[model samples]
Target: MEKGIKAFQCVEWVSKRKVPHTIDIVDPDPSWPTTFTQLATGIRAALPATVIHAVHHVGSTCVPGLAAKPVIDIDLIVADPADEASYVSALEAAGYHFLFREPPWYEHRLFALYAPPVFVNLHVYGPGELDLESARHRLLCDWLRKCPADRDLYARVKRESSERAKANGEGVGEYTEYKGATIREILARAAADAAAAGQGREETVEAGRAETAEAGTGIE
Candidate 1:
């Protein structure tokens, strides 16, 4: 939970309609943690031994007292995400559908489970790629968790953004864009805090890499 990858007790692939295009921010639910734990367990069971390096419950949902859009955001850190063929097939068999491959975004690979009982955005990233996204994600989450003022501000901005999107007939994409300003502001503060504490992005990426090394390329 400290923005570092930790090996979790073991923890998908398929296809279906993508997530809904609407944005509806709701009060934080008590069940988010349970959902994440259950999902992590399922993922561990689905994958072959040693395929996953670390499983982290990231995003706003992971922060207590933060309102979110009711969807889980998970960061699936691997040794080398670019080597998708090594693990993608096993994930597909677990009922997770490949959504997109965005090399420009840290060679990120997104997978999702859109059926009942679980709605998650599985973000896969490797250590060698541009690790900006993973660093920012964990930093911001940890920051909001520690700072109550920012947490309230984020909740307010999210609610207003969601309402504005609904009133203006805007979709989730637009809502996300509308909230980008606030998100950046918060991230700026988080980044500053991280730097002041001598924590750098390279350290974060290396943490994942270290885990992968410990995991030892054991994909089946």
Candidate 2:
């Protein structure tokens, strides 16, 4: 099937189900980590050894003291995704189905857990060089954990968006377009901040290097 059609099909499938925004506001269960640990172990076993770099439990489940859906999000860094169609199929055989093929988010290939909303989201990103996946995952988790004030704001936005979408005819595409906008905004802001921080770190390193050179010490 065409990618667009497949996306629409996924949306249509999701549209039939109902999810309340309260799902977002609910306190996260402490067992979330254990569940994620089990998921990561299962995925590590199922994946082809060659393609794997690191499989991690990301998203809200990985962050302590953060509210999130009960679902688990796992990130996989592959050596080469384009060349590993077989690995994708292997994952499919393990009961994960392709849901979103989001390229805007750094060549991401998302697979959904068969159990539905509370299921797993496997984010496949290429190579160890692509730090975007892990960085974004950490940023979101950190932001939510440290900034409790944003939690309700996020929840309210999510709840309002969810209700609005449901009223206006919810489906995969529309739901994604709606919710994805918020996610994208958060990501964009985080990315800008990371770039700035990286620049500052480089500057600090350069200053340290000058000092070390003056001291006649070799670079570490």
Candidate 3:
């Protein structure tokens, strides 16, 4: 599918059934990474290697010390997410329930696994489809890993959002929306830091090249 806002107009819900649940944000679990590793392993084993591009542990659960909902969010990059025939049956056989898909928004497809002791939100997308959104996820995760201040700030917002959602009988969607502003603020900081780091690297490389050229001229 062609990617862009025009594609979003074709958003389709595979199932309209809503699952009832409370928004419970918990303290960081040390086991989250291990859980992701095991899950990723199973997912890899289930599908053909040719179709799988990358599997990433994303979202709040992946960040250490960051409070988050117990659910783990994973990003599974496939050759073509819109081509469900290539891997959907395999994922289902592996216990993932196929969820809705947003064809316009990066050819995004969602799958869920509600097994006890571990809940997972498996997000599927094509390689180049999630360029911007994927970058945002990467930057936010990298920044949270190193920036204690923003991590704590995000945790506080998550708790507050969860509390408000529970009090108002809202679902996960509302809870996520409640904390959107804070997430955007943190992402902005992360993007600035990333840009600065990239510029520094470019300048350093240019300086090294200039020094090498000067040294070569003197040797002759």
Q: Which candidate leads in lDDT?
A: 3
Give the per-residue lDDT digits (tens) of candidate 3, residues 77-192.
Answer: 89988789999999989988876787666677878888656588788877763433444565577788989999999899889988998899887767777776777677667666
> What is the C-alpha lDDT profile of model 1 across 71-189, one tens digit per residue?
78888877777788877887888888886665544566778777554478788876644455566577778888989998999899889989998999887656776776777677667
Candidate 3: count the clashes. 2
Q: Please tell me which model should have the higher TM-score, number 1 or number 2.
A: 1
Candidate 2 residue lDDT tens string, 12-31: 12121223212332456788
- RMSD (Cα, Å) for all candidates, in order, is 9.1, 11.6, 11.8
Off by over 4 Å in 1: 1-16, 202-220
Per-model TM against the reference: 0.80, 0.64, 0.84
The TM-score that candidate 2 achieves is 0.64
lDDT (CA) per prediction: 0.68, 0.54, 0.70
Clashing pairs in 2: 11-172
Task: Identify the superior model by lDDT, candidate 1 or candidate 2.
Answer: 1
Off by over 4 Å in 2: 1-27, 100-105, 128-134, 172-220
